[model samples]
Target chain A: MVTSAAPRHAAPPVHAGPARMTATPPPIPTLLDSDVVRPAPPASRAIKAQVENFSFFYSTVQALADVSLPFRERAITALIGPSGCGKTTLLRCFNRMHDLYPGNRYVGRILLHPDNLNIVAREVDPISLRMRISMVFQKPNPFPKSIFENVAYGLRLRGIRSRSELEGRIQVALEDAALWGEVKDRLRKPAYDLSGGQQQRLCIARALANEPEVLLLDEPTSALDPIATSRIEDLIVELKERVTIAIVTHNMQQAARISDYTAFMYLGKLIEYGATAEVFQNPKCKETEDYVTGRFG
Target chain B: MSTILSDNPVSGGIAGSRNGGLLPPLRSRSLLGRLAERFIESGLLLAAAFSVLITGGIVFVLVSESLPFFRHVSAREFLTDRLWTPMFADPHHGIMPLVAGTLTTTAVALLVAMPVGTLIAVWLSEFAPSRLREVLKPALELLAAVPTVVYGYFAVDFVTPALQAFIPDLPTFNMLGPGIVMGVMIIPYVSSLSEDAIRAVPMLLREGSYALGAGKFTTAMRVVYPAAFSGIASAYVLAISRAVGETMIVAIAAGQQPNLSFNPLDPAATITAFIVQVSLGDLPHGSIGYQSIFAAGVTLFVMTLGFNIIGAVMRRRYRQAY
Candidate 1:
């Protein structure tokens, strides 16, 4: 069976026929200029989280350092970094959960709608901004509620009062999260009764109920076992067709496995941003190369 | 975060190494330590037992006092009878009027509390930011801890007059004044309990609602409220119990007369208030007068206990299973 080779940013082989062994290559630059691969740029600004000069600070501590990048619309963009490198912090900024904690400060523009550029101002209404960008945390956090109610939660908030309408929506959202078949018969059952994986899926279903335009996943599969992680990975693909996604993953394999684009950050700075294969194989920046190649955290 | 590795000579390390190897090893039991530990454990056990025992004793006493009334007067007549003339020589001590009065006050209090308390909870939990929420939560709960007598005093001195200005013929001791005051007293019970429940809802749920383009108020009212309903329902029950069992406020603000009227503007009496009226200062024990107070006490106890049971069961059935 022919499979599409791993998407761009994969390092092309450096062979001996090119005299690469004899001629010690200079410390190679990482970034592959866009012009090298495709001649002309696309017409539309097609991306979900367009961060322009985005810098975030928690009180006096700087978290994200002037990170400028765009997450392709409906295409998964993985922010890969080690612990405390600000991937989660950056992800939280999209949905504004950081706003809940005091002393969270930021200076930048994060654009959800590339078409209209609605969030150019730093003082955008976070509630409305957050509504367009749904988030799933690292741990599965289904409310202490029934499975049906968990999925129905966001839909109900939208004033979908009719039981039939709610049920229909709950079914669709659960199905979208790939959790319906297992929980379909037990909608009234408590959410905690489900397996860890199922609970994560139910949380995902709850998020989906609101029909968000962008989904932010902060190490969503970190706590799940491999099988559940695989299921979530598959669901991410299925979800992408409808809404944009920004995923923060520490696992390099996860980034390689699922994302269309990958951004590598180190010490709270976006070191490299490009197609996943290009970023992984031929990181233009020494920092990105060192980080991605396992030479440095 | 860390332990120090000191080069102490004998006593500090292994009880002697840091202190020139002078002291003998101490066993796990020292006379003082053993005694203190035992005392502490027993104290905790006794404290916990007393907590349970106190609750049990109250239930036992209420039932013991109520049993004779139930035996002398059939449960059906006590529950269904229309008149409440406990002091009357002919003995027309029907409890229907008292129950009706209790229900009227409870319903009106609920009507007042559910909306205002829920709104305050929503505002405190969802709308208000950290600085304001910290300031407001305690201030709101302070409403609950205010002495009941003080609330009663206000009901008579402040609320009754204010109410009369609107309703010209309002009675000085009317259910409306007490019911409204009771609602105010119980607001903290509803607001704080509900605010906690709403706040407990995972941030993810709120985020999902927000992402759907629904407003904050919409998300809180629709999403968080229903998710926290079981807890909120429990809170409501708690508030109702508080309203129904309140004695001083209703006794002073609402009239002592048990004239079976459902109208809020008219004077009516609740079971607890009637107990206060009957049990005031000099009521001879073993007499029916004394027994009537016990009977009223039993009724109040039963109603409050029922609310607690319902609240607990509802919470258990509809808990945050996940």
Candidate 2:
């Protein structure tokens, strides 16, 4: 299943076995050479969004430095990095979430495909741009409202006031988020009454209500239990057929289980980017290999 | 329960000792210490009861004084009568005109305060820079600290003249001047309380709205305002009650004449203004005029109490539990 997703990649090298992963292996001198090459990704996938030479800053401090990568259409791309490594920062740049705060700055172009609009450009209004690229936060932060209203919030923002239209879209979004079965009978109940897992799905339903092309998840299941984590992982894998997804996760197992493509970032640089199997099993960079092999975060 | 108690070795030993000749410790207290503790407890209880006691006393006085006025003037007449001319030869004790005066001024005040105050609150919460918020919040609060009488004078000397320019025939002492000035006086209350409520709305909710492509205005009005509905509504209701009970402002600027006119340009007397008007005069203690103050006081008390009840109900009804 993993190999078919990126058929151009050769078979996984035998030396890349987990048992061979070492903490004290001598650094390869060939890797230090500029001729170090990364495996090419399959050419079948279309680009959904591109971050070109993107640098991000919070007030005076720079968060991401010259980071560039392409998100494949209808594919799940997981951003893996330690805390404060610009993984979440780069994810937020896709939908311009940083524009809400005053001092945070996006210093490079993030081009959304088809029309090729730079998300951080002067002409694009962050408010309207968000409709096409919605985001679910780190914690399941559903509005303090009913289950139905929580899912319907984004639709209401778009001025869809008809009862039938709202009910229809809300049903679809909830069904898509796989929360309709448990919550359909008590849609009027407050979202807070739901467990942590249900609330996270409700948030996903909220983002899906806008019919966004790309969905960003920032450490979505960090607050959930193991059962909820696997449920969300399964939901992400299924959702990739309909929407392009970029998730920032600290959990390497979650990234490996769900994402088709993976980007490893360290400090502020894009350390590695390729098909998920290649990045995880046959990492090109020493930092990527070490981090993926569990030598260090 | 006995088996559970016996499960603890320490308690079982104590129980065994109790069954023997040993008695529990007396925890002997000095007489002075006992007295002091009792005295402090009584003092605390008295302090807790003081407010209820004062409220009961006020109700007793009001009802006792108002009974005599109701004897001459029927309860129906006092409640339903259009005129309120107790000082006149005929001595009409109708309070509707005073009520109309209070309602008119409160309506006018709310008209000015509600929108302006809510907008100010939104700006302070969502838009104001940190340094600007630090400066603006205390400055807005200073408006509330100004004495009502000072506000009354400002109404008469400044607001009345400024309004008179546009409204040429506007009375020198009209409900509009005091009502507008009272609105200004209570702006800080509405703005500060509502600002606190709006600010208390979780940042996550606002971020959720923004992520859904909602503009700042949309988020503030649709999400933040509704999320903080109970607090904002209660703030407005409390402001309205303050406007209704405002004495010095209406007493000075709103004329003593109990005109039952709805037009704000005309001079009118609020229930509070009438109380102030009657108290300033040298009437005998048991006279109808003297007793009429308590009747009006009772009316003002009931009206303000109703507002408080409504505000409390609103605070609970729409409270968005995070």
Candidate 3:
């Protein structure tokens, strides 16, 4: 699956022989190399959104500095980085989540394709932009409402008032989030009654109810147990057939397992971007290689 | 263990050596320290018990004083009788008129308080800038600090005349004036408490709504409001109790006559107002008029208690709901 997703490039050599027999190890990559070589995505895939030289600030402190990356249509793009490396900051910028606070500013353009709307433009309404690009938070944040109402919330925001319409859409969203089978009989129960994993799926169902074009997940399974995390991973992999996905995760194995493409960020900059297999096995930049190999964060 | 011995030389040398190099006992060694701890615990327990004792004392007095009044007037007449003319030459002992007056004023006050207070709370919690919130919160609390007597006069002298300009038949002494003024007085309580509740709701929930394309008003109404419903409900109950027990405002503005009418424009005396009137008059100690106030007092206590019980049940239900 990994090799199939990689774009055409000079494949890195694999060490088939035992490393101990060589009596010496390969040279470790150093951070002095400045150039970042981002292997292009396969030609068959189209770009869903392009973030161009985007910089973000929380008051006077810059969180993301002149970072550019692309999310391919109907594909999973995972962002992996250490804490405070601006991966989550860049993910939040896709839906303009920063607009909720005061003294936060966006510089440069994040252009949504097809119609080519710049999401970060001051004149663009965050509400409308958010409607097109939905987000699942780092922690599950289901509203203090019923299981049914939790999924129905976003649908209701779009002015879908008919009972039948709401029910049908909510069922579809819940099913898509892989939670309908467990919760079908208890639609009226409070959302808080659900276990942690189920509640996280309910949040995903809530986001999916809007039928957003792009879905952003910010460590959506970090708070879940292993079984729940695996279930969510399977659901995310399944979901990419319909919606474009951008995820931020600290887990390197998770990025390799689930993502079609991966972007490694460090110190508020994009260190490397390529197909998941290429980035993991053949990182183009020293920092990216160091981060991917767990040499240093 | 060695680090601990090094850190504390006295305990390592004396206490440890006394225990044959074992760590010293976890319990305090000083008798004075143990005694001081016991003293503090007893002092705290006594402080807690004192409030409970006072409540028991008040209940005992109300029941005891009410027994004498109930002896003179049958329970049936005291409850069903419409006239409460205790001071009349041929006095009637019915409590219905006073109950009606209390209910009418309370309903009017709640009508003015609940929605207005909730709106103010939502604005402060969700939309107000930090500087404006800091300034407005203290100013709103200042309204609560104003003397009830001053509000009473304000209701009678300012509010009544201003209301009369619109409705010419409105009486100078009517429940409407005091009811509105009392609602204004209780606004600070409701808004402050409700704002605290709304603000206490986790920001994560609000972000969930906003992430789904919800505007500020939508998120405030659907998400923040329901999340804070229990706290807001408690604020409503407190405002209801305050309006029910308010004495000066109703006594000064609403006339002292007992009229069994629910109309806010009607001149009537609430239970609290009647209690104040009877307390001021030179009625004999054991006279029926003097005993009548106890009956009114007990009735007020039961009504407020019912509201509080209902508020508690609702709070529990909502606290679990989320």
Candidate 4:
């Protein structure tokens, strides 16, 4: 029997091992080729976050259902679909932003395997989880502060108070985000002085300052112009070498251009996932092909 | 007014409303509109000019009345001396006592108002749910609508009794009771202003802070709070000025005894309370006794105006929101 697993609170293991996955595709059209020749990358062998029968609920309504997939370690993974396809919700689940809202929850098995453990345990400290998986938002959301303080905000949270230490971390993080040269001299200036694209890069730098192992971007360049978008795309390419990256983007071309691995999600289901090139060029699932080729969401 | 009179494109410019780094010559329209426009525009301008006229009249009245007091008591002595006793046969009054008392009460009141009001504002804006937040915000603002005299009554009866229990030797009428109650009255003003400011912080900033592993408290303080500080501070300064000028609470609850003392447990009078004490019943108009009240009013006006101006400057210096 095919396993119908789910993502939820409580240790997902101990009750199971070597689980089966679901076959439901998302709101996006699955490509015909994704069914036949999904090019699973060698890096997927080192899966970091594994979901089995992963289902989500906003109070009572289930947003996602029976999603079984492994997020590959140390690669840029893209979650692509039309709006309300549960991509952003799925991303939020990885760090539990839903905890702030009342009665909202996730059910089933989501496993983060550094210690090879399940992540959905009731005892999981969400703060630490968030520290490991830092997120940059769709809009450039800098604090009302100097550029230096904006980047130092995360480090200050972990109790690094020394100015010199904060400065060095700020420099390294900005360099990591590919924003050092543009903003290095104007560290004392207010963050609002920067252009829309620069502010987004500054946010990326801010997230990296905490030395997070994974970076999650939810449409990080959606508010930016074309020039800023390209700058961020370049930054994302450099960043993949240092830390794992996951992005949820509406722009499929952007997903195709920058991602190492791509998951096509439509109607709250992950329809097809494989190599970025494969998912775009020759998707096995017919729905993915239609969505990719601009037939329909 | 100029808008109706001037069909000239120069209306959009102090210099010129240049776009894309290129200057265009002023565009004009309808010569007929320009002809009758001056008379109509002048009438509107004159209407607008009345506000300035009213302000100038008040200032002229104040200066004319105050000129005699300055000849008898230099501005230096009136400002620096702490004791005020113009009612005494010898008449050795000083404005310092009133000024000091006003500052002390206002400062202490701010200590109370700023924290309580800011916390309530934060709760109203960021933490509370939509339905509850909607209900709570207006309810908090209703605190401001209550008559100051009612606050004075509450302070006299409820607040003074409570204080007497703690201090054992508390006065029946003291600045402490009135100042605290006055702080409570100003809470809505602070909260309303701060709530608007905090709500103005974009949702993205809060979401970004949350994503960085910061708790709600951390996000509110480090991110949201600082972003809204300019507006919140203006609210606080306004509250201070209100506290200094507040008459009913202090006049009825805090005994009108002008002295250079800050011990809130002891009876003391602010400028407003002193003015109220003097103004009660006719005290021979044009006498030094009656004129003293105007002197206090002028000082009160100047103090409040200074606070307003300084608050404005600081707000402009740090203009930022995100």
Candidate 5:
């Protein structure tokens, strides 16, 4: 299942030209300087999930306000903004993670495609919905279990009792995560015995074990060193070919380098949504331009 | 100072100070401050060392006193022969009966405490709402605050009578009543410590489980329990130690006859109860009968020490697993 290794620090191939020069020093782009309109994702790709006028409240405080966005099929959508800009909040709403806490309310629907199920509906079970939508958290959080068992956890949850089937699926998931080679000899070792980067990959392998249709990543490398972060970035890029991916990241260059689409949120509002190249190089929204150009965040 | 500043890039900027000294030469501590610091350090050290000294002294006393008793009774008889009638005209000093009694009562207490305490901990840590947990924890701890003497009476006066209704053959001073009461008394120690351990597990782990679609029960059993295993193991050990060394409940409720029987329905005397029974009477200070209590004390000490070693090893193993 291995593909040719992408170059380290590779920018999205579609947008790898002069347009991507905004990352380096240039005359600081002012809010009024750019007039380029937001370029939408091409109509050829199908929408995998859509957030329709979604708003969220933690008791009385609204963390997300009337946010609407689309996750394109088998594509990486990056959510970027300042801290508490509701990027993570928006990503969590996809799998009904807020349901874990009381007094957290969702006012609009997150419609999953194919089945078109309203994931946030009260009648819908968050546990069952989470089966099809898995998540990798900000910190690497492999269970206090053997590496093999960590990968097999979600499979066992789905009642995969056959030992051979579990081993096969776990192998594929670990291979897909690029971790099987490093950990193959000692699958019975504890997950924490691995380094931080490997632990995060084990988490990804754990999420992948479910073969979920959608995968949510919340700052999956914020805790790692640059080298480990780059490895996870490479893995995320490869993962988008199989599962619809949405990521929340503070690293703007990272968002630019990996994401197919970019959504900029500010103060619980979606400031802009478009192709990653347009968002970084030529944002339609002034806040998006100011934030993306490192003028302010 | 100039040499130091020239060698360090960060400190070079401060080299132009009027005095050649770097940062005012860090004001020397006053004599009074130095004295107070020394006093506090030694005072804290003494406080810590005080407990260790007391424990060492107790072990010395138990060993010295028990040496006389072993000279009077052969070690093989003390270990093997079941009869333990030290005050009889023809006394039999076999310690087997007391050891058997202690083990039986402790086993019964653990049978009741381990499972019940663990379930209570899981409920408090994973299932209970925060407000409920806040109110419930301190209230549950009140179980431990109730004096052991009260638990002893409750075992004899209330529990034994209640059990008698169903099992008419159970004697009034049967070990079963006191064992269950001791377990109830120890519930707080186990549940409270286990709850703290389970609660201390980082939220990230639970989120990982939930993201995998595991329900609250599954998350608690599969993820939280194993993650908190070391802490829970220590809690269990503490409960075992508490039950083994427990004095009042068994002394009052379980009959003080050193009967070598494992049956819970039979009256028995644990090591603690035997000690209490002997210490109450006036035997010559250095006599074998009086010295037997020290021998019993040593056995109890050994049992608790073994348990603590097992707990420490378990805690290290699970901590390393993570």
Candidate 6:
């Protein structure tokens, strides 16, 4: 659909012919200059998951209003906005994380294709769905069990009780999260004994053990130190080769460094979304530009 | 710093000391004020020591009173004999029957209270909604505030009659009746303390479990329960101690007979009940019968003290730092 409201950042690809340059690309209007109008790019990109005209409410308060975006497969999509802008809310909708509470209502459809399941459908069981689309929390929350048992929890839920199989899978998941070397000698030790960075890595390993199709991270490094944050950022980059990732982060540089696509939300609305490089360097909406340029949140 | 303190009482002592690199001196105070401060400090210390002094006094009394009874009757016979007829014409003051009676009633109370109390705690902390929890928690705790004599009456009038229908030969006053009523009395302690401990576990842990695809039952039983195990165990120990020290219910409903039997339906007299029996009757204050209560009191104190210590150690050992 050729809606004129395509994110100003994702302008239609420049025509190859030099003759079209003379027409002058439609000028973006400054706040002072209101007469200019520009056509936005078509929202017809191939997508792994499509949030179609979706809105959400917590009791009577609307948290997201008719947000629509494409989550591409095998790539990192970062949801960035100021606090209470509904970025985390949109990320949680991907895995139905809000199902934990009562009176949290989802309206419209979040159609996840290939699997062809609308995640918000009443018939869909949240427990089984969570196995396919797992989540990581803001703070590191490893179980009080041993590191081995913490990593084995998800696998055990699926009934993988054989010793050799559990050991092999635990090793592989820990290695994938880049934590096996530090914790290999202490697999039987309680998880709380690990350093903060190591604990966060252990949580990542726990999620990896399940091999979910999509991984949702909700500000996974907010409680971490700088060194731990960088390590988690690197892990997120490496993980996208196997699993689709949807992350909610307030760190713009981290998003610019790691994500392929970025969706900027404001006041529960998708203000702009496109390739991260383009959205950062050249935002289409005035509000998007202001947020990326650090003028205002 | 001295000048600042004398000039400005509004500036906290900390700020003056921090900036000046010297503590505000108290020596400049009037002699009378200094003396008053010293007196106050000692008064507070004495108040703290008063509890220790009382504990020591109880030990001294028990040991001195019990020493005379042991002189008349050997410690070996008093401890090993199955019969405990201290007031009889040919008295054979064995402590076995009273000890057995205390254990039987305590075991019955724990058997009835542990599972039911823990289940109620789990339901309150994990399953109940906030609105329901607000109403139910205080209502359940109100059971503990009911006087023990009232529980005794209820046990005799209500519980024994109920049991008589099924057993057909239930006694009027038996260990089972008081034990069941005592279990009901102890339920609130177990449930309230366990609920507090379970609720103390961080919500982050529950969210972690849910994020890992665990259902609510798995989250509650596997994760939350283990995290709160020490607290729940301590609650159990405290509840058991409360049951052992319980007096009025057992004295009224568990009979005055000192039978050395494990049969809960049979009439028995717990240590507390025997102490009550001896204290209420007319006997010379210094007689062997009167002195026997002190020995029993010492045993009861040691048992309850052991339980409280165990509870304290468990609380320390399993405390989660987070």
Top of the candidates by DockQ? 5
**Per-candidate clash tally:** 25, 0, 0, 36, 0, 2
| Model 5 regions more than 4 Å off | A1-43, B1-25, B320-322
DockQ winner between 2 and 4, please give it.
Answer: 2
The reply for model 3, stretches above 4 Å from the true place, is A1-44, B1-28, B320-322
> RMSD, each candidate, Å?
7.6, 8.5, 6.5, 10.0, 5.0, 8.1
lDDT of 2 at A77: 91
Better of 4 and 5 by TM-score: 5
Cα-based lDDT at residue A40, candidate 2 = 34
Interface C-alpha RMSD after superposing true interface residues, each candidate, one decimal = 3.7, 1.5, 1.9, 1.3, 1.7, 1.1
Q: Give a tens-digit lDDT track for model 6, residues A50-119.
A: 8889999998999999999888887788898888999999888877778878899999888876878999
Pairs that collide, model 2: none
Off by over 4 Å in 1: A1-50, A73-75, A95-134, A143-176, A186-193, A203-214, A238-244, A281-286, A293-296, B1-36, B59-76, B281-283
Q: Considering just chain B, what TM-score does every model have?
A: 0.83, 0.87, 0.91, 0.86, 0.91, 0.87
Best by TM-score: 5
- Tens digit of per-residue lDDT, candidate 3, span B1-322: 7666545545545665778867754443478987999999999999999999999999999999989899989999998988999999999999999999999999988989888899999999899998999999999989878999999999999999999999999998999999999999999889999999999898888889999999999999999999999999999999999999999999999999999999999999999999999999999999888999999999999999999999999999898333
The list of candidate 6 runs beyond 4 A from truth reads A1-46, B1-57, B73-75, B168-170
TM-score of 6: 0.84
Chain A TM-score from candidate 3: 0.86
| TM-score of each candidate structure, all chains considered together | 0.79, 0.81, 0.90, 0.82, 0.91, 0.84
Please write out the lDDT profile of model 4 over residues B130-212, one tens digit for every residue: 89988888898888889988999999999999989998899898878888998899998899999999998887788788888
Q: What is the DockQ of each candidate?
A: 0.33, 0.51, 0.55, 0.50, 0.65, 0.53
Q: Candidate 1 on B1-322: residue-level lDDT in tens?
A: 0233233333244655656668764344458987999999999999889989998998788778877767677767777778888677777677878877898888888888999999999899888987999999899889988999999999999999998999999989888888888898889899999999988888866655565455767778767887888889988998988888878988888888886788888888888888888778476776765777777877777788898999899887766642
A188-244 per-residue lDDT for model 3 (tens digits) = 999999999999999999999999999999998888876787788878988998999
DockQ of 4: 0.50
Q: How accurate locally, in lDDT, is each candidate?
A: 0.77, 0.85, 0.87, 0.80, 0.87, 0.84
Candidate 3: residue A30 Cα off by (Å)? 16
